[model samples]
Target: MTAARAAGAHADAVPDLVPDAAPSAAPDAVREPAPVTPEAVAAARHDLYTDGITACRGAFGAEWADRLREDIEAAFDEARRRPGGAVGRGPHRYYVEIHPEQMRGFAELADHPWVRGVCEAVLGPEYAIVELGFDIPFAGAVNQPWHRDFPSPELTRTERRLTSLAFNVTAVDTEEDMGPFEIAPGTQWEHGDGFEHGMFPPRGEFPRYESLAVRKYPCRGDISARSALTLHRGTTNHSATARPVLVLGVDAPGAGNDAHHDMAVTRAYRDALPERVRAHLHCPVVDELAPIVQKHTIEGLVMGDA
Candidate 1:
């Protein structure tokens, strides 16, 4: 049975399967209707707070998208050549965490007005980048079970405010067969027993039906910002080409814990970044190589144990 059906069954089996908060309206029925504009950014801020996720289509121009796409291809080639690089998650899926400074044309993305605006809206003006990596799901990759990025029972139990936001930018147009990112809207605020444990719950334990999981299709240049606590998963990729999306994390000042990823850039590169972009980086610059790669697995990808 599908995860949603199984979750429903589990609810019936357990008398007090903590009922999920009533789901919000289906995302498709009332999808955000504006392009990435000043007004759209404002609306997106509201959506991020209320729905826990939002997208800005064509936030960057086509030229910028093309440049990013080329960078991704180059990064992939470079990773494949380095030791411990181009790690496999499953069949065709792979991932690598590299320094943004090493990728040409990527530095601009961190300072892109629209991208920075959305991130700042949710993570606050003092927000800083906590993690950076590439998520590439190729053909034959299977769907991941629904879960949050960093689940902290303690934070969920006491904190009602959003502390961190995830930023995703597609290197290429995300077609349906590419298995674009999917999310269960509005689950950011829900907390349950054992929710803060380091591990994800079984598939059957997810409230897939209640959250109304929806796949997001963002074309080249589109960017998405979401609360890290929001329930989400990477779906199956049936297309011939690999889908590579840039993953970035921004945290409110003093909002993260010890588990967050720490990355560094060259001193020269760090000095060149705009004050806005530099403020989000908590790590200091080093002269050595950046972009550390390690073996990848579903467990590592989900629980970050890797």
Candidate 2:
């Protein structure tokens, strides 16, 4: 009958939002378990990634793959001009490239309807984009130490906070053998200053949080994101191929979570996004009072990169 109906037939909503897959030897091998259909992948993704929900992959195709490729390319192009402190030789990663149109387009993916529902599920309709970015791990990239993006209040500090979220482009497609990122869900809610920067390890070396990292590493051809408070990290990219990903940040509209405390600096980078894309995500629409878009800096872990 209905897709949601069928998904619900075999699965009960799990607290994590990401319910378990069909009983199989490769449980976390990326699947579309019944009840947790691709339609529900976002729901399951959010749950497993954030509120502890999980679903299965019901839909997959070339169109989806191509779209992912395009976005990854756009993000990379944006990253080239983007700036931040350097970690050895890699990019500092401070600006989010996906503008409104891209954000809307990404949400429109037939296979990811659950993403919108999940975002609405947590923050409600008024929720504006908090933050979104793309990650391209080069062959020699360093391990993005275990950490959690804190939902720090904005400069205005008036209840304005954004949540951390993401989806996979599967540029490299991860399995136990290879990986782009590894997640430790709910550790964002685990309530501890855990890890080097408050992150939950996906596997070994975490003599502490490793015990809770029971979830299998997500295989490639998957999409994932987490609540504002979820603990995670972009572990070392062991694969020879560059692992590219499109990242998204979700923050309420008009809550003081703009580029940063320095409106001028915010304008510089926010203005840097593709004009068309910016118009799509208009959180008051990028205001270019200045003639030339230039660089400016923020105070501290302002979150959302730029």
TM-scores, all candidates, are 0.78, 0.56
Task: Flag regions of model 2 displaced more than 4 Å.
Answer: 1-60, 81-96, 100-107, 110-112, 151-169, 192-205, 214-221, 252-257, 260-280, 284-306
> How far off is model 2, as Cα RMSD?
13.7
lDDT of 1 by residue, 1-306 (tens): 221232243321111111133212223324343554777678888898788888776566656666765666566656665566656554556677667775666667788777778776766787777777777776666776666766644655586778878788887666788778888788787674454353355556666633588788876667888887777778787766567788777777777532445467888888888887787677757997665655322344544211
| Candidates' C-alpha lDDT | 0.65, 0.41
Winner by TM-score: 1
Error of 1 at 274 (Å): 2.0
Q: Model 2, 1-306: lDDT tens per residue?
A: 221232242332101111123211223334542454445544454465444424324233434544665565544443333233111112222233444344324444322445555555554555555444455554444444444544333421233223433434443344442334555555545544333343333334454544445433543345554553444445444544454555555554554444631222245555666543343244443454322122222223223221
Weakest 10 consecutive residues, lDDT, candidate 1? Answer: 11-20
> What is the TM-score (0 to 1) of candidate 2?
0.56
